[model samples]
Target: MQQSAVPELAHTHARPIHWVATATAVAGVIALSSVAQPGSATAAQAAPGTEAKSAPAAAAPPSTTGVTFPLDCGPVKAIVVKKATGDLDGDGRPETVAVVHCDAPMGTPPDGVYVLTRGADNPKPRVVATLVDPKDRRTVTDFALRARTVTATLLGYSTADVPSCCPDLKIPTTWRWNGTAFVRSTTATAHSV
Candidate 1:
């Protein structure tokens, strides 16, 4: 995957979102793949032999189209808040982090992460913070959020391609979401461990 040139995403965050196609916003049109659609429910309960009006129920096919989205970079993440810490900004004070993580959506387009942290000035309610990946995998080892300050480790963004959605073309580049739109961040080979 390649890195995107868009800098706005330098301090943004990314999230894994599932877009379901209804009449409005649909993740994508899912076709038959391994998982088969189920039969429709009979409407004979309410009225004797009334034809069912709803569409046939289909089995949720296994997530096939694995999306390849880029994430975790400079300005790419506005701020990463760690749970368990009572404060965000330093100075023996409590802070509320408000970020616009809109880039969390899937795809090479740079997404944004909108985060909001709130606390009080007097006898504030200390909220614990815990950050993790889509797989619920723990990332931040341990840290504290002080007033106007936040500390954490680097983010390792992974692809969310199911191959089942857009099988013909699985994005080969690292796509990023910069708050409002998608941007190619960088190629997977650009950086190394």
Candidate 2:
């Protein structure tokens, strides 16, 4: 008996090919492909019983799309207050920075700085962002908003024995608006208060 070389060659060369076809009334027939390009019409077309809804364009975040404020700011209480007006958003319009004495815990007296922008929808200004004392060890003794930089004076103690009623050490810090929020940009040493 002669070994059959022809039969073995035919079996080795022959392979099955699989194809899938999906049909939809609106999108017509589509053949599935492994490598599909993004944003292509065929890629976006819905399959079979499904319908495609167009995606909406991306909207800018509130912090980027600066709003004008005369917003209903609700209720706010402050003892020591100061206001600064300038173009903090880089826009031509002026933005108001309100530095107010905020309610704090028994040991700490913190001051809050509020950034408000004007809006046409309401006469009141809209509050955009607020910055309070960053650390818990001390209270905000004094603060000033100038040229977009918020400078604050912090009063604390160098030794544990010092009384919390009146802090002996004074630390000065500076925070600047970097588009999104006020970040502490500069740090200074403590001095006698």
Instruction: Score each candidate by Cα lDDT.
Output: 0.31, 0.57
Model 2 collision count: 12
lDDT of 2 by residue, 2-71 (tens): 8977656644554443112222322342333334446645565679899788876442222312433322
User: RMSD (Cα, Å) of candidate 1?
Assistant: 30.3
The TM-scores of all predictions, comma-separated, are 0.20, 0.45
Q: How many clashing pairs in candidate 1? A: 87
Top-TM-score candidate index: 2
Tell me the alpha-carbon RMSD of every candidate.
30.3, 17.2
Give residue 174's error in model 1 in angstroms: 22
